[model samples]
Target: MFPQSPSIASASNVDILIVDDEPTNLRVLSTIVRSYGYQVRQAISGIVALRAVQIQPPDLILLDIMMPEMDGYRVCEQLKFNSETKDIPIIFLSSLVSGMDKAKAFQLGGADYITKPFQVEEVLVRIDYQLTLRTLQIQLQQKNNRLREQNERLKQEIEIRQQTEVELRRSEAQLQGRTQQLQQALDELKLAQTQLAQSEKMSSLGQIAAGIAHEINNPIGFIYGNLDYASEYMEALINIINLYNKYYPQPHPEIAKRIQVSELDFVLKDFPKVLKSMLVGAERIRDIVLSMRYFSGYDQAYAQQEDIHIGLDSTLIILQSRIKEQTNRVAIEVKKEYGEIPPVNCYSGRLNQVFMNLLSNAIDAIEEKLEVVEEPFHPIIKICTQLSNSSKQFQDKNTQWVEIRIADNGIGIAPQIQRSIFDPFFTTKPVGKGTGLGLFISYSIIVEQHNGQLQCNSEVGKGTEILIRLPIEVPQSLDVSTTRKVKIAPSSLSLESDIGEM
Candidate 1:
């Protein structure tokens, strides 16, 4: 049967020791402590209690203040001094009834003190209280030790992680540097490839242009040379016929009839006009051949000082067929506002290629506008050029720059894709219409090779303007370097290629 104490200590098996001098008192306390579900041991004196406690400490101790040789205070002091048994809760059960005696007991680390003639309820309650407190202290100490151990392990792990992070960061930095170097090499390789392809294509075009010019110039030269002689011979024959009519008015009826049948008077009047028209046609052909040679620039392969307007005019002449009236749209009107800019030192052929590309794009833009819009619209491309300075276009004052602007009234580019227009293989034109390398190559030629700038400004319904600024005297040994950064204006346009223009 359990003690009816109704205390927390009764739930667990607890060890308790009762120390007293009286055998009867020890027996009585032992029964009560045992009934409370505690394992009780008895020591008849303080000395025996201390010995028993040293052997195996109990959860709590009930010590008596009056005992032979060693009193409760001395025993508690001894127990409190020992590190192993200091935490054991001690309750004093004594016959001494003085205030000093209870005070001394408490001073020596006694948890509770009870006088003689103690009620069983009071003694058991004190014992239960001390035991419960001892159990709580042990649990708290255990938790504290575990927490300390976990804290030490966490600190070690954190140190290891920090060292690993340092090494990883060092490796990452090395890898990033290597990646950047590799990327730079790749870009240079791609640039070289593009330049080679461009050179081959330009060479082929120059060869074709020169061949055609040679083929046509020979026949056209012969026809042009004979036209004048033919005209003079016709005049001499007419004079002889007039003289014959004057000297011999009476002609054979057969000759006069033949003359009447052939409409001689009308032929005589229109013959000079025919010669003049033919002469004009021959002259036009000669001019076209000259323009083709000039545009091809096969002879001027290297950088040289040349009139930019000449190249512009030559490109326009070559593109005359495209600018002519189309089935869907009227002839595109080319408005040239050329300034009195001096000859610019450049690769004339390359510059001409750029001009051809830009002009062809303008025509395409106009064609696109015509296809989508139903309203009557006259397509126009405006080409403007002038000398600019640092204040004008943010160039060096010492170096004069020529600015060329090619504008077209067409379906302008949307704002969102404006930044990507210069990227390689990017295009807005339908599959077969564009090759997407025109603007990219043009950008590379102008910015990288010639050290020039290309800029675009546009509005959706209004128009697009492409501006090119180049130094009048380019570097003598200009090497194609890295691509320059371009700052696009607020609104811009996309570009497509006419690879056939070359």
Candidate 2:
């Protein structure tokens, strides 16, 4: 039926198995496969084909559908069920060329189909297509496995990175917290250093003032005592002259000549007035010395009951030289509107310093305004004191407050600068002219030291008013230690109109 031996040149290395019950069909298919350079195998039945595949799997199988012991469908099903041979390509080659038969072959995992008595070229082409498909499938499966491995590695790397990020965030939070704590400690230390320096400076100034005042007192007392004696001596001499005139109606010629030369009547008339003037000048000096002594009482650190007005008077007296009229400008007029308020419990020396700063600043403002104003301007500093009943209505009803308003008609502070005027080392004056610690220390004294309120209100080109509200009785609970901490909150200085201008 077929060639007994077909001579063909081998051009490829593909392995192909041909299964058929007829020897002619098997021989014809094998010869055609070998001519295409494929290694060929033969199986007489479906059972034999399956056994051949189990023993040695081929790249592709050409199966005949109608077989003796087992059919091609059953053999293909068996081959597909076997994991070892499932991936191998199977093509149906049969004499029965019905559509149903081809469908059954395909359903059982056949890769292709060829009818019996097929042309040699068609069979060879079908086998070549199947072998190529199998090779491509194998390559595709290997690539899929590699991708799966790479995907697993990528997942592990992503998880590790996520864990690293979490740890880094935790470390950052801890470092941030530590940085904040260090910053807070540094700030507190700076504040303490500033306060200590200020206190030492004030203490030194107080000691100097006390020493000068003491030194001045000695000379003043001697001058004052001598003046009183000098006045009495002059009075006694005048009396003696008067008595002599009374005893003798007519003077001796020598005596009369000397008396006339001296102008006795005129001397007698102005002698009392001269003594009175000297006494007045001495008394005034004494008053100034006393004010200095009161102002320089640094040893009086503890709170004591003292006349607030006395401190105000002493401060004004000390600044009297600045308040006087100069050749270039008119004198700054000071108006006092004192109310009937009792003595306040306070640190007298510190309170005096507050008064001095406020008054001095008021004078400076007026002097600054004098330079720009064209109209007739009277520099006025108005000081008012009043006992406020408003505090009695507060939560602490027993607390009595005295409000003191120091107002000046000068070049007013701008709204922006007014807010930070009390901040330490913040000054509007030129360098070396102001240290900017005046108002800051004053605020500390009134608020921190005396538990009071200091507020300011100003209008540009108009004037400024500083209001001080001090408790009549200092709080007993405050620590008097030199190292006592003062808590100053931001925005502590209230800007409000609590006192009206004079």
Candidate 3:
């Protein structure tokens, strides 16, 4: 008899199948397996074991190798081939103890093997091990599935984060673009306001100039008219006196004494000279009044074909007083290199203003330099004008351009300050002495109104040159009649007094 197997009361849920041709051997295995608290089923042959497994599969199969019709190897192989029974653990129990027999049983998918008269305890241990391994494999598969799920969720979260970051960056860029646009609009508004103020000031000055010119024209007309008649009358009186003196060569003593006392000969000779001098002075005054009218641009209501040289000359004449010798310095010399250029179509008054500003600035620069220089310095302002061909310097080949350069040997601007010289409200002059709008307005007049270019080149300790390039013919689309008009004001008639202060 086989030694009794240990009792396993807690393994009641496990089921075992005992298969053999001999009833006694089957009975012995069943008793031992049942003692371990397992449900036991018996089969007499391999065919019977397979049939029984088909009906109800067991957790473990104890098989005998030597059978009457079929062997344990064939039974195990058939059970292993069935999908429903393949996972069941099979143990071989055999009287054939050869190694080949054991190997054949294992090759048929047997989990363990025992010879005849095997210990019951060894059979129980093998069954427990195989069941434990199967349980662990199932648990590992569940853990792997959970890990896969977690990995997929993490990937989704990462994608969401990346998309959110992209959206955030796009929003920031849009905000920055809007901010820049707002800033640009604000700057433009400020510039327009400044220009409007400047225009109003110029307009008021022009109105004042027109009124003064009208007032002075009436008196000047009569004075100029009467001077010619006065000269004729004086000549007639001198002739009468000459005839009387010739007729009365031998005068009475009383007459001779009276003539000597009065210095009659000296009076007769100098009287005509005094009349000539008076006539010359009146003519000079008339010319000055005319030049004042020209410099004021009172007649420029629309764009007209006019000589730029005429405008320059009138401006110079108005500024003559400043150019003359000052108490502290000698006269400032002005050199003109005017080229043979045709008349240009432009607002003559505005052009005069540009010239006035540039010349006044040049004079101011020279005056400032005079204060600092120790050597004998003769301040010179050189103005040159020429026709520019269509080259790299000029963009339009169809249109003719005139280039004017006004240069001054004075306290030149530094490189850093040169860039901002044309900006509104930028100036080097003291607070009460300047308004800082002269150059800025000049630049706007040339570049914006006339579609011209204004450039400045300067070096410290050397000099400054302001270059202006303007088209000779105004564009057909630019309607001068519709443009803002600036007239000469009485106060502005004196370029040196008005613009020089600016």
Candidate 4:
């Protein structure tokens, strides 16, 4: 029904052009090009071929060197010179059979020479190879473009990741630096607290020393006066013994007996008085030693609660020698409002140290403002206790609190200096009279250690009032959400009213 299709025309869709002057040659070349699956364009002359190439460029050109109007040499040169069609390879198809002919074909810019008696297989193979090369070039170009895009994207992602890592490192370094700073500050604070405890201990010893000196002085004075009288009695007794020895030089048994007996009488009369004076002096020394041993026995202060009133009793024993003489110097009144509460857990030594500071300060204030130049006001030291549910100091509603109020009718703290009094090394006493650590240490123990609050309320020219409120129990559960902790040293005494007073 239809003309049989040629083998080359069914093979591939590559567009190939054949240029030749003879109709037979054109038909034959077209057939050969089509057998390899190429789409063939036939131009009878170089002019027609150029027009065909301009319309649709072939992958390769099979050009005939000889033509009536435009030869293959001119066509090849024109096609090679034009940028748009330069890469279309043109192989010359010529009938010239000479070395000169081949040379001329090459010189005319023909890529290859194929004589008129060309084998169809050879022509097909050449066309297929050239077309394959073009396809490879297209693929290579596309691959290169893709690679460039990927490289750029990779570079951008790498830069972003690097920046993020650097920022993270910086943040981590800052956090580490802050942690180190906090640790150093905590270390310094602990060292400072240790030094303060040592200083307070020394101050307490100093007060004890002063008290002892005053106490022993009185006994020494009495002993010295009694010795003077004994000296006089010894002089009289010496005269009597001398007279008796001179008068009774004869060795008589009865006389010796009478002399020994009279001497015994004289000795009995004076010995008892001297012995009593010496015994009193010895007792004073013994008491001083015992008091020092008792006060110094405690280990360095930590937190624990002792009976507040019990501490008062021990402090009274320590201050007896100092206050005994000043008894008439002031009308002193003592009142105790002791509660049935158990011994509070607090730093026993630190608490005693606080009492010593407050009591001494009160004495000094009262003494300073005493209207009777030589006498002091009726100094009354009142200690009162109230069981309050002071939840302010504790966050738990179940916490039981006890309030201890120590009020003094003495010169009060000036408003301007009241705030600064709690500061370490702040003192109004003469240089050696105070070390300025008492209230500061007290503040640390009460507020910092016991989780209590210390407050001072006073007015100038009026009396000072100090109240201490403390929770009896700790909360059932506390959140340990923070890594930082306040390390507390254990102690036997607790500060219920561990308050700082100015």
Estimate every model's Cα lDDT from 0 to 1. 0.80, 0.80, 0.77, 0.65
Query: In model 4, which range of ten residues has the least summed lDDT?
Result: 480-489
Ranking by TM-score: 2, 3, 1, 4
Q: For each candidate, give its TM-score against the true structure.
A: 0.64, 0.71, 0.67, 0.40
Q: Pairing residues by index, what is the TM-score of model 4?
A: 0.40
Q: Please, what's the RMSD in Å of model 1?
A: 7.9
For model 3, residues 145-188, the per-residue Cα lDDT tens digits are 88888988888999899899889999999999999989877766
Candidate 4, 1-502: lDDT as tens digits: 1222232233455677888889998897787667655678889888989999999887779988888878888899899889889877678888887999889778766767777687776776666555555566656767888998898899889988889889988988988999999988876676476555665565567567556766765766676566667667777776876677678677489877876877855665766666666767666665555445444434444444456666665666676655554644635455567776656666555556666666676666655556534443456566676676545534566666666666566666777787677666778888988866666666665555455555566666555655555556423232312123223222112334321232
Candidate 3 similarity to native, TM-score: 0.67
List residue ranges in candidate 3 displaced over 4 A.
Answer: 1-164, 248-285, 295-302, 388-392, 395-399, 415-426, 430-441, 479-502
Residue 158 deviation, candidate 2, in Å?
10
Where does model 2 exceed 4 Å of error?
1-120, 133-201, 224-237, 298-301, 391-399, 473-501
- What's model 4's lDDT at 61? 90
Task: Write candidate 1's Cα lDDT for 1-502 as tens digits.
Answer: 3333332445345778899999999998898778767788899998899999989998888888888788888899999999999988898887788898888888888899888789888877777667667767777888899999999999899999999999899999999989998998787677666656766687788888878988999999999999999999989988888899899987899999988998988888888899999999999999889888887784354689989899999899899999998785689988888999999889888888889889988888888888888788878888888887652445367867888888888887778877877776678889988766678778877777787888777667666788888887777877544444333332242333111111
- Highest-TM-score candidate: 2
lDDT of 2 by residue, 422-479 (tens): 8777788889887787888788888887888887777767778888889888965555
Error of 2 at 173 (Å): 11
Off by over 4 Å in 1: 1-83, 93-109, 116-207, 221-279, 297-302, 327-329, 368-379, 391-396, 409-431, 434-444, 457-464, 477-502
